[model samples]
Target: MNEMKEAVGNWREAKQFSPADENDFLRWLDKADTEEKLFSRLTFWFTFRGLPADQNQRYHLVQERARELRLWNGLELKLRRWQDRVADEYEQIGKEAFAARIGEDYADYINSLTDPEAAPQQAAPEPETAKPAGVQAWSARELSEMVLPPIRHVVEGLLPMGMGVLVAKPKLGKSWMVLDLCLAVAQGEPFLGFPTQQHGTLYLALEDGKSRMQTRLRRLLEGRPAPANMHVMFQAQRLGEGLLEMLGEYLDANPDIHLVCIDTLSKIKPKAKPFENAYDADYDYMGRLKAFADSRGICVLLVHHTRKSKNPEDSFDNINGSTGILGAADFTIVLDKQSRMDDEAGFLLTGRDIEQCERVIRFDKARCRWVMQGTAAQLAAQRRVAEYEAEPIVKTLRVLLQQGDGTWSGYSKNLMEMGQRYAHTELAPNLQMLSKRIQELQPMLWERDTIRYWYNSNGNAGRKHNFRQERADNNASVPVSAQLSLRHNYH
Candidate 1:
């Protein structure tokens, strides 16, 4: 009965009470109840009884009356508590979704942001792109079309990282020298004065037998131990077929190999016209070789030959055929002998990356080896000796000229006087010997004289060693008499 009465009272209040006024009413009720507890009980009954009859307004009025009576305060606190519980549940669901879509680390980062104690969030790192495997297919046309890398001198400076070709005439010990270089590199020894960086080396000698290679290697080593990192391939005939294919696999298996020497390029490249239009064929072969080296960061040393040219000075320019060969090579080294059968006399070592210099090495026939005998130091010593031997003769000649109106009549007394002043304790053979040495030095003096005459010569004869009447064009007339006075006779 009290419930019914309370409901009826709420409905009635709903018709007359505004939402804002209800709170005031509730405050009044509380005060009223302070005076009379029964007053508070009666107020609840009246609030329910005055509820609005309209469905929309009925709920609104009930809420209003509850507020007027202070009943809604407790209800609102309960509702807020329920809402917070649902929010926490939804937040966890969002985190799980993020974890599935991206990654766990991302989810954790996002979750941390909501926490008051979490640090400032950072951006995720970018993923790396995968590189393609195996050698990239490059046409000779492609390489030819692109600009070339700058040429670098080998021994002169840092040998730029790339492939190299060593070309020489037949029977020039090209193979022996290349093998020597490989052994030197493997052992971390110096090669032809160029420092060798420690590296694993692979030598493919198609022409030499295993036994012969061993013997030659022993000779080259000359009691020196072979570097353990060095590897040799005696299967020259098999190289033509699928050699590159196997090489690709071998390099993959052995990443440490830094140098590869192919004794002769002709052995590997497919048969083609030696002197005809084989640019395409040649380019393809070199392209493959270059690709192999570039892919593995290995230096490919290719042995090659020169065409039979009468011009002895022609080195790189005389390479067998197809300028494409030298064009493709990163470095080109040419081994040339100054004269035939004078191997001991000296050999010229010139290359794109090395300064052109000649060094004399002796061939120890007994041991079948070539050893460094005339290095820069050794040559410098020899030069000092020659200069010492020739000095007395030059001094004697100068003194003789100074004594006798700038010309010596005979060589004997002049030689004796020169020997006394400048020669070592034991002088050179005779005046003939000194004369020969002087003759050798004449061209050098002539060159110096030309420069001196250009600088010193004036129209006045007083400033010149020798003067002739000027022609109409102002050019000095050639001296007729070989004997000329040194002292200038001024006008």
Candidate 2:
């Protein structure tokens, strides 16, 4: 209600100038020296509303004074009502537009209007939870008590809440990649073939301003709708000053935020290494970030850099830090490209809850996002498949088939449902569109009456070879072409 009143006051002030007569009357009213002078102007500013039924003598006396003053009582009433009507319409239109912008259901928005005074306001929306103020410890005796809650991931089993670091060499599209992750989580969209939990993200791009961030984000979004959950700030305070307090206030305003990314920790980190050990100073800086996340149970991703090393046995060794930065974090992700000129790279992921796994990912120049294929060795063997050039629907079908050995058969409608597994863009329109896509895949199909459905890939042939032998051993007469090739290389 306070927010609404503030907005209304602003509206009144701005629109007061719209009506020329109101502006003239208001300017004079402000200059009035006393209550008598201000009240004299009101007779010309508004009509006196009093009736013989009025019990109050003050109301009758005011009307009598207005009649004696020969003020524009009739015209004043007309202008005030006109201004109010215009303001009312404008407010209604603004509310409708705002509701539509964030995809709020229109019916739900209407129901909320029933009790405007009772409606909760989100100055900065964040999830609300109550916590025990005092901490105590008890010896855990049961497995259930000791087990951690189901892990919540920002990048599904890859990144979770706590002080974490994402290290990559300079000019390696680290910003682009993190922005993609932030936007994906904001929209509940997929990132690198994995599902993401939707939540608001605060991206502090301390180095780059709006123009650079805008162009980079535009490329990442690729004409998609912007996510309301994602916010970007171009500046931030340094640690140990007001930075920690500023972060706390922001989280208080936006309590639901799951991910807070600070690009290039070097930018905002204190320059003086006050501690004795190299690791200690680094840990001291990150320790503040970890404490912040721990208090809120949220994720803090500190983007850092990797120093050039002579082929370190482990990628984690390449991170440009001593034990302080490394030990301070709950998780760390290292993206290392063999060459600065190439987009292909290996993503090394390690965390307390996750297995240390390496994934093969390549930058898609067209989409400006990394495409996760498989382990480096697996991707090396399948380079000839050309999965990158395949249509989204076909590419999705190919992955489904490659996952198992069977005749994966489905109708056109089913194909659309399956294709959504890899959907990063708008959903396919209908069954007809999906059927047309299948026809374009050049798959082995059953078309005795009409194209019932079918798919096949080179990878599927190897896995399905055993299936064919079993059929042949049974003396089955079904044609091999009719086999639903789950391993169909739609790529």
Backbone clash tally (model 2): 9
The lDDT values for all models are: 0.53, 0.61
How well is each residue in 229-292 modelled by candidate 1, as lDDT tens digits?
Answer: 7888876543357887777556544545667888888888877756656777677678777766
Q: In model 1, where do residues sit more than 4 Å from their true spots?
A: 1-160, 237-240, 273-276, 344-491
TM-score of 2: 0.52
State the weakest 10-residue window (summed lDDT) of model 2: 462-471
Per-candidate Cα RMSD to the true structure, in Å, reads: 29.9, 21.5
Q: State every prediction's TM-score relative to the real structure.
A: 0.49, 0.52
Q: Lowest summed-lDDT stretch of 10 residues in model 1?
A: 448-457
Highest lDDT model number: 2
lDDT of 1 at 271: 71
Residue-level error in angstroms, candidate 1, position 252: 2.8
